[model samples]
Target: MHRITALAAATITLAFGLGTGAATATATATDDAARVAPAAFSCSPGNFCMYSDWNGGGTRCQWPDERKANTADNCSFIQRGENVRSVWNATGHRVQYYTGTNYNSRVGSTPSGQGGNLQGSYQIRSFKPQ
Candidate 1:
């Protein structure tokens, strides 16, 4: 009788442990899905916009059909040293961005009317038409 009771208790504990692990994994997956959901696009036409969060979820800075040798000059978020995790090029031409001021250290570019999430690992300090 004692051996049977011990086995039953162990089995219940193992079942509960497995159930809890599955629940935790489900919650983690839900959280990841929420984080990756697409954010609203708010950039205006004929403008170039940069966001500090993935999928354009955080602070934004925009420029109208113009080259910016130093984005932090007038952009509050850039000035605060936030990374540019997304960009929307609503202008009429492809826009190339850089990791340093004065268009140094070229990173990438986006075509007109196209934009999406970036690697979120670097800041865009300058940008101009490609």
Candidate 2:
């Protein structure tokens, strides 16, 4: 009977300790919320437009509005001086493309993205292809 009582007490203590640890962890994450700043941007919409403007000093070109390229150029020109280019698929999935806006302007590589961090890796999920 004495052993059973001690075991029960220890179990309660252990559970309480674990609960306190979780509370501490959550508190720490909450405290650092503000310090966790947004990653610095080296690319922008204009970077994409540079290709639109001329494909790297070539000539302002227009992207086709097809399933393979919905609003892909769907929206207006990448924006002036903006380098990070995010476009939406037909269903409106926002994808940040790479710096060079070639036909396969796949994200994850660019002059500005020479040394990208985890945040630099962009997604390329299928959209309406627009």
Candidate 3:
């Protein structure tokens, strides 16, 4: 009777341990999926748009048919010192952007009607038609 009771206790302990481990693994997988999920793009047509987060998530600053020598002048996200992680050029011309105001320290450009994720390491302080 003692041996049977001990065996049942050990089996219950092992089963509980496996269940806890499986639960932890499932939670980790869920967290990973949330981190890699792509955000939605929401820029309008005929405008240049900048995003504060990757894949067009977070705050957006957009200008329509205009050049901005100082994006922080009117863009709330830029004024808050948030880096532009993505962009969309919904304009008629190729748009060049820079890391410094007045077109200094050119970072890159997005051709007309094209855009995607950026390095997310620098701010877009200015932009103009290329």
- The local distance difference test score of each candidate is 0.79, 0.32, 0.79
lDDT of 2 by residue, 1-130 (tens): 9999999999999898788984654454334212221122212221222122211322222222222232234333333332322321112122234334443555442222121232313332212222
Q: Is candidate 1 or candidate 2 better by TM-score?
A: 1
Off by over 4 Å in 2: 1-64, 67-79, 91-98, 108-130
Superposed model 3: Cα runs more than 4 Å off:
1-39
C-alpha RMSD (angstroms) for model 3: 12.3
CA displacement after TM-score superposition, residue 115 of candidate 3 (Å):
0.8
lDDT of 3 at 69: 91
User: Candidate 1, overall lDDT?
Assistant: 0.79
In order of appearance, the predictions have TM-scores of 0.68, 0.21, 0.68
The window of 10 residues in a row where model 1 has the poorest summed lDDT is 29-38
For candidate 3, write residues 6-109 as lDDT tens digits: 99999999898788984654454344212221226566666888999988889988888569899999899989888999987767778999999998999999
lDDT value for candidate 3?
0.79
**lDDT assessment of candidate 2:** 0.32
